[model samples]
Target: MVFGKVIVSLVSLLLLVGVVFGVVAAVRSRGGSDNKNDSVSSSMKSVTAICQPTEFRDACIKSLGPIAKNASATPKDYMLAAIQTTTEELKKSLEVAAKHNVNRETDPINHDGLEGCKELLKYAVEDLESAISMVSGSQVKDINDRVRELLNWLTAVYAYQSQCLDGLDKPEYKTPIQDGMVNATQLTSNALTLISGFADIFKSLNISVPDLKDLKPSTSRKLLEVNEMGHDNYPIWFPAADRKLLAAQSAGRVRPNAVVAKDGSGQYKTIAAALAAYPKNHKGRFIIYVKVGIYDEYITVTKNQVDVFIYGDGAGKTIITGQKNFAIMKIGTMQTATFAAVGKGFIAKSMTFRNTAGPEGHQAVALRIQSDMSAIFDCSIEGYQDTLYYQTYRQFYRNCVISGTVDFIFGSGTALIQNSLIIVRRPGKDQKFTAITADGKEKSNGINGVVLQNCKIVADRELFPVRFQIETYLGRPWKPLATTVVMQSELADFIRPEGYLQWDKVNRHENTCTYQEFANRGPGARTNRRVRWKNFKVLSPQEAQKYTAGRFLDGHLWLKYTGAPFTLGL
Candidate 1:
């Protein structure tokens, strides 16, 4: 009996040893395969790092570090996350731009649609460049495949328009059904081109790329939908719909509160009238509540108008309109604007500033802000050329709609747009639609930049195809290392896939410009094929969040009194 028991124990021990040896052998085999995969992923990572813009390299590192850990301990997983995040961001930007333009829903030419288109393309190209270079050993792709697809998609969308323009005919519609067919063709072509690019890039990197064509057509459509309306990013400070609730005081122009437009002696018809009466270099916050009316006048809040708050009944109710073109005015490139604000800490709410310069013109800036710690909320700016200018310093716009025909939002300032609307109008018969932002002159100390978040974009003229030329940019590296970020936004099909434009003769595409995006979605947001990665990219989610108003825009100081919700998302 003792010998039999001992034999049973020995057999059990032997069985345990065999199982352990088998497990060790399996682990070793898996380790070898994992090392090979890591090698490829690591190579891809180095390439992507090399392609990233120098100024934004730190942002890229910061963004990718955590994602790498979360992605199965493989560099490929992290790279894929980066690519996906970038594609989503560009899509969001385009969607915001498209929605903003559609809200006005007028002809692209009449509504400054051309300028809007230009700006969209500019930023699109900038983002495409980044997406194109994003690579992964798992996917085995280079930046070229994405870039080619992006270019083809953009070309397909704009090809007919280019043809129409080449034919010297104004944008027009064929039969409604025919127009739909054309749109379908453009979309189909875009998908095919993007798929080809994706496949080619994967082939180059010794990775098996998916045949996007085999995927359901709805796949791309669904992605576009997810991108356009998704609100992953926080809209904590919507300057366009919020009130700047300035502390009330007994100073400046104050009379009987008035029953009607007549306030006894001189109660001031509009806030502009009151501002004109106020003494220069006045201390404290000056409140100017404008009554509801379309005031057709040009305003200049000079440096003397410091620490003043201008409020109105509502932004749409108090409309300011003017008909002026920088070309006709013969102002120099730097000085070509309609309204110039050079004051410090200026605040405005519930106002509509318009420059009614038609497409046959040059720069016509509607509102040029050049102040430090300035905020504009719940406002509507309309113009043909330079519409909302960031002359200098830092400024924030929330819940506002900006419409223009040319480079509408441009300049050198630390500007941020949250939950706002941007419209791009079709340019003149011979021109293009360049819209959104035009940032020049990079600066240290967070002085010169622009960021757009949770916004909608739209374009006029359904069949109107717009080209994103070199001059149009979401934001330029005007001052070397010019920084612009669009994060977790929506983009419309109207956005060209090329993504960004360059300033005429500006050579900062490689070294200084810092353009990045994250978590964007839309038909226009697909980055499987985009521009060269060496020149542009999709930022990691962590890097992209730094541009948020609460995180980067003075830590809620500007939004505190602006009446906007402080909704910092987790």
Candidate 2:
């Protein structure tokens, strides 16, 4: 058995070497064309021009110029060659990683890391192979589609190589496999850069390509125009009357329409009573001030209560608590929140919503929001699982503290959360991992996503045993097209290197989920070990801007009315 294993390893290594050498030889042999025509030299210059704009310019030119030396080589041929070269380099790196003796029994972390790298590299190879096949098959009729697909596949290959290295960056492991990964990453990055320059190449060759244009209104343009409308530089989305109301509230010049106190100090004691007493279908803002006390009642702001604002003394001082949970009450997840807001333009401030079901009672939601243009500020949502239910429509959360275990912040809404603290609680014995979000955007055209900007993700150390190991996942797609982006955040060490998780072992949503992270800092901000899902991206500054508060939720048009402070762009 040992001899057979040795033979298999040896054969694999030899096969990897042969594949690399074959491609290299094929490239080198075509270094100079036999013909001396001016047109042939011009085509060679086109290839050089294409490589010049790449990140690894010299390496790209050296590797691809020979492959493009054939006077008959088309843009598709050059792209295929670049992808083939990238896949070959990844295979070489994979072979090197396989040589390491990563035993799970002795060194579980490193072993898992190595095994994960192997899987990622294998996926990288497959991505590139698929790209090559697509280009060869002439399946894509549109030039724009072809270019986009090629760029996406090449980017995936580059990202996968980086992910492999990220998984290996641990104190417990030391291996020469990193050297191969470094080279492979650079090679794939160059390939991606070269592929991205295809438009320029096509332009130079006088090849017709589709006009690249963006039809959506620019966020910067909207910001500038919107700012012009407000004298105090407030968001243009807020109407002058609403702005006056906010100014009045800020100056303490406005009185509440109704007051609710647990004691008999007010006409209405419970929050539900206050809502019931307030006139229904009111177009103007109706303010309800709840005094300091734990209002142990389930509250619902129905659809008829429009533009309602609920304020409390403070988050911890004025609490709303319930014990309903899916496990104990046999309720559906959406119906399990202690507080449910179903109206439009609902705003809440300085209050705590709690589900007292504890960790054993799973899927206990503290707050459920389905209100369009709803905003929560200076609030605390505490529970074990499914804490804050962002059901649908648009919402914004600011300066809030949310503590939970699994899918703590979730829903199908297009929500923007800024400057909030996300606390991942220690799981119960039955739970193995914690997921911060489970977005359910099911359609490609739906402008529904969860964007967490400048937030902090921390673990609840007090809930765990001494030296207990904890792994937190950023999110998993509840629906195939689910989108979530965490940008400019600080992550605690408890966050796993993989960043996001598959929905399940069997019905994995890895390929279709749009999970991304950008410019986040901290020990868990590492991106290399993140899943190599087809749509997962480490976005550029330009791309990340699209998911900012102002852009993602169209905050410039609505957030100002809620009186929640937010940044206009990333």
Candidate 3:
């Protein structure tokens, strides 16, 4: 029996090596192209077929040409080469950004932005590395098998490679930095475009996507499950955090790994100190119980700190506040987050994250969560503009309050907010309108959007009476293919009958965007007077479940264990 198993393993290993060697032959064959034999041209031509579909064909071919050896026709090999090439190119950009960080011209003003670019590029490197791992693995066959998730990560790479320049104060100052980052940007774009147009690439190679329709969510859910793990060993109070977390703590049911209090009563006074002591390679959730206090500091939960659960006294009492603003501080919008979560499986409850930048602050963010499978419950996110930046990956929020003036609850990620309150604050002196969300899902195939489910939208006391004077819109397309769905929610009367405003009145992205409201109630929910955009629709019950927590985010696979109130489907 052992001999037979060993034989099987050896056979599989040989087959895997055979597939990779074929591509390796192409890299080796490039040097021999000058020989002009039919074999050499065919070898090079076969590789060129892969690059033909990319926008930067020459760059695409050249990117793979340098490191590649010999030849193989497997699409995965070419993709691996492309991803690796992108990763290498991004490292160059990171070096350039680091040099710019200390440059005298960038000394005071552009230094922070340059530093931000370095950080964003580092994130891009991680995304590229993950891409390389995804395709290089033995389990993945065609990129098409995991294309949905691949697009999400690759799309993020494209976004991050350039967002650093977007935050620079001077338009002309960006040209040099943008030029330096263009190669990685173009390569990232090629990888994303290649995956997006994989079917076309396959057709060019005279083949069809294997078992395309047979692909199931269960299989993809399993893939998501691999990157993250959680235990259902939460105290009884966790499931109903707002109602029972405090009581459970008092009852000695909740056991936390660490305690942070402002009065120095606990083991740590600062949340940062608690996070600094995060155990390496620790299994299961590391719970941190924060006592009631108004802790004023900028908090960043870095990527290495995974599965850290922090529950505070309450949103009203235990507040994490910052006064960072873009216009005032010159820190980029991406850097202005009062609280940022870049880790995986981060959970925060009963806390208020507030940015006091006000409307004039222009893009100040209260909470920016890029954590995969992160959940925020019973919290309040307050800011004047750009309050909640759900940057990427799948996220869940429930029973929270989010208030802002412009593009507040916005992000380019797959997220669901259930039973939450959205307060529209009065705009700054220069601002004439208030937009609630700016959905940044750029690709049509990308699994990203902000879905507000069973929520309430209301105007704050200062803005309620004057709400009619200021055009309050549900959302505007932040990207060409942006998407947002407000399902089974209550939209107060102040929201305009037109529902949504155009991102650009002249260009009007509504024709290309997806803005939907399904079974939403209240006076503003009536869609009779709504803008008849090309993709806007009132979805039927039959089509609603696809956007629900169970299907949209595959929440059932993970949410069940979070002890949060969530419906698997409509």
Best by TM-score: 3
Residue 37 local lDDT, model 1: 46
Instruction: Give the count of colliding residue pairs in each prediction.
Output: 83, 1, 14
Candidate 2 C-alpha error for residue 298, in Å: 0.6
> What TM-score, to 2 decimals, does candidate 1 have?
0.52
TM-score of each: 0.52, 0.60, 0.81
- Candidate 1 structure quality by residue, lDDT tens digits, 43-129: 334434322432344444444455544534443444344444444444543443344322224443323433334343333334344
Candidate 1 segments whose C-alpha is farther than 4 A from its true place? 1-266, 270-272, 333-336, 443-446, 461-479, 505-511, 533-535, 565-570
Please list the residue runs of candidate 3 whose C-alpha ends up more than 4 Å from where it truly belongs after superposition: 1-53, 64-69, 72-75, 102-109, 137-147, 197-222, 225-252, 504-508
Model 3 deviation from native, Cα RMSD in Å: 7.6
* Whole-model lDDT per candidate: 0.51, 0.72, 0.75
Candidate 2: Cα lDDT at 63 = 70
Question: Against the true structure, what is every candidate's RMSD?
Answer: 21.2, 18.1, 7.6
Model 2: weakest 10-residue lDDT segment is: 1-10
Error (Å) of candidate 1 at residue 454 is 0.7
